[model samples]
Target: MFADRAHAAPARQDPSLGSTDDPERGDVPGWVLITLMTAGLVVLIWALAGPALTNLFEQAIARVSGL
Candidate 1:
């Protein structure tokens, strides 16, 4: 005695492999991914530049003081 009409229709399988039946599982949105990548790049750049800048400043001071 199933009365639901929606369930009466046959379910269709997608031709595309690895595709989700639901839209929510798709890859992260473009803007969100870009923001995340930008944040990561900024952090990486700062980490690499910090020590190099400190060393350069120390060398400059030493040269000026004849040390």
Candidate 2:
């Protein structure tokens, strides 16, 4: 009984026989580009504002300690 049903089932096409476009292509490169861009922006912002931020923090600390 089971054998008849199994033979009646349609054959599935092999994945290698399908479209040339890959489902997972470029996934890593896209993430790497995004991560690199974010890192570069963070570095640029830090470089531009690092001294000012440090001075502000030091002033705030001095005021608190003086009080």
Off by over 4 Å in 2: 1-26
Residue range 1-67, candidate 2, lDDT tens digits: 9989887967776987764467856577889999999999999999999999999999999999995
Local distance difference test scores for all models: 0.85, 0.88
| Candidate No. with top lDDT | 2
Per-model TM-score on C-alpha atoms = 0.40, 0.61
Off by over 4 Å in 1: 1-28, 58-67
lDDT score at residue 13, model 2, on the 0-100 scale = 68
Could you tell me which residue pairs clash in candidate 2?
A: none
